[model samples]
Target chain A: MTLETNRQLEDLVAKAKSGNKAAYSEIVRMMMRPVIALTHRMVRDREAAIDLAQDTFVTAWEKLSSFRGDSKFETWLFTIATNKSINYLNSAARRTTERLDDVTVSRVSNSNPEDDMLQGELRSGVMEFMKGLPGQQRAVFNLRFYHQMTFEEISNALGKALGTVKTHYREAVKKLREHALAKGWTP
Target chain B: MNCRECQDELLLYGGVEALPEELSNHLDSCEACRRYLDEISEIAARFRADSDLVSESVDVERFVEGVEARIGRSRVDRLPAVTWVRHVAYAASILLVAGIMSVGLRYVDRDSPVNGVPPSTDQDYYAEEELDEGVVDIVISDFSSRGFLEAGDELLNDVTEDELKYLEENFDVRNLLL
Candidate 1:
């Protein structure tokens, strides 16, 4: 997951490794959304996303000494985040994913599917469409869409092959379009 | 290509930019598949835009504080639940061994008759030396999981395997340990 800003986080990482809580806090502030966004898409819930994202940050802090700076900080950081999210998803203990309350658009609550496809409902409709995607596909699509990560970057972040990542993205696109047409969205 | 095959092919290039002759001819013959590919592109564009609109805004300060609070604990204290269980089990095992040793050494009646007969001459007994004479290395496989057990402070090696099994069966060890 790439941050939009190109600000260097390595200096902060060094300070953090040397036991600067303030520096670590700054890193968390910078990375909170991208990490949360990935977790949210992976787990499909708000509270769990925050919990897993916090776990990622805390784990990073504990393991900060071992970070060799071999890869970009964001790449390393996202690898941890993505792995945690995937683990939580695979773990039987993961809480059932409630539709994220933070998502702002509740799932097209107009009672009539056709009537709900008005101009104002597209955002929520899209949210509904996205919610229906499989967890891995959702993770792949969101990393590409929100973070502007290339397929290779997402593949590295997700620990998937580049071809597999593209396949996930392509499948996700196909599913979303089919879902939209089924919901009466015209060409 | 048939519609399924044609759609699969179109889904790859995502709406015919470099138009392969075979797929282009198929698309020209098939208006519905063309419409399907067009809708796929449109959906992708709209999805990108609309997903951006859904607010994923996080409370940064609160989130940072949460991370800070978690990391503030010692690494051992912050171990996950399964690891914590292993730690507790290890610590409890040491305590159990010590308790069993004390029970075996002090409470066992070496002179008592067993079912109206005298005890075997070769039966194992407690050592003459006390519990503090030597260190008992309780070799827990995962060292990180061992939290308690201050080494030589609790060594009770005099208890034999028979004594441990007998004591384990006679006593409610799990309840006693916990």
Candidate 2:
């Protein structure tokens, strides 16, 4: 977010927009962390997340020429990644949702029975909790809570209305709070 | 409002800010619902403090390689269409140029011969050409071989112009350049 870093990023984007693969490669290295992190959170599978992220970049490259500089490149990328994840979730909902829920619930069930968890354990625990939510809720919660994005931004990213994004977030919080209670968590 | 409606109001309105009066009254009397609302608030606050977590298992090099491969494959996927277009354009250009040159070469050399034979019309010009030249060739060759043409310049120099004119009028001489 620093001016220098942002300037460098814009330069990279310009080069990439002109079809510079090396510049795009640099961009991939720079952005891989957050991109993959968001994707992994969305899909709850590392391999699928990587595949989705790869798809995101390839798509971005293919369409780089059409990219007008209206939004931050990362925001644009996050939007694409978010939508791709949502589509993946929607298509695979019947096949994979239950399986993923089982994995997350079982893992969370093995967490410390005590109401309180250490910060590291809590973070991982929350990650698993996030993984357990339904697709829209997971996406809304991740963008809203972790990214601190406004409801408006989440709406744009998810291609949903403002009301829908808020609903999804609230639903996610309710699910988390109830799950925490079931696990004897204090907060 | 009952607990279910109370919780739903809290979720929809984001706590009691826009909760209906009935829901507010329910929350005041219900300790469990109050705790539920408080827990959701606390979780939100806690999430704000933690930074985003990235999985350490992601291999950047491998991921980059995969993207590069996909890009290359997609380019390859798209290449055939462009190549086909180029192929059609090139074939059209070759045909166009060849047609133009064919017209041009014909225009520049209307009577140009191929393999020493002139192009002709409906008649068998080959047979006509052979008849025209065959007699002249035989006369020249025969006269030279008989020593008549070989000795004719000296003999012809002695003849008068009057005699040559007589020969020209008396013999059918139209085929001769004289």
Q: Which one is best on lDDT? A: 2
Which candidate comes out best when scored by TM-score? 2
Residue A91 accuracy (lDDT) in model 1: 75
lDDT of each: 0.67, 0.69
Off by over 4 Å in 2: A92-124, A181-187, B1-42, B45-54, B76-178
In the range B28-130, model 2's lDDT, one tens digit per residue, is: 8999988867876676566444433444456788888889888877764476797999999999999999999999996557466645766566354433343
DockQ of each: 0.22, 0.20
In model 2, what is the error at residue B48, expressed in angstroms?
6.0
* lDDT per residue (tens digit) for residues A13-109 in model 2: 9998776788998899888777887887787665677788899999888878767887778877888888898888788563555344233223333
Q: What are the per-model C-alpha RMSD values against the true structure?
A: 16.6, 14.5
Least well predicted 10-residue stretch by lDDT in candidate 1 chain A:
A100-109
TM-score of chain A of each: 0.74, 0.78
lDDT of 1 by residue, A1-187 (tens): 2354435577788898888888988999888777886676666666777888899888888888888876677767777887787788767665464354444555444576775565347766666776777767877776665555567777877779988987888787677667877877756
Please state the interface RMSD for every predicted structure, separated by commas. Answer: 4.5, 5.0
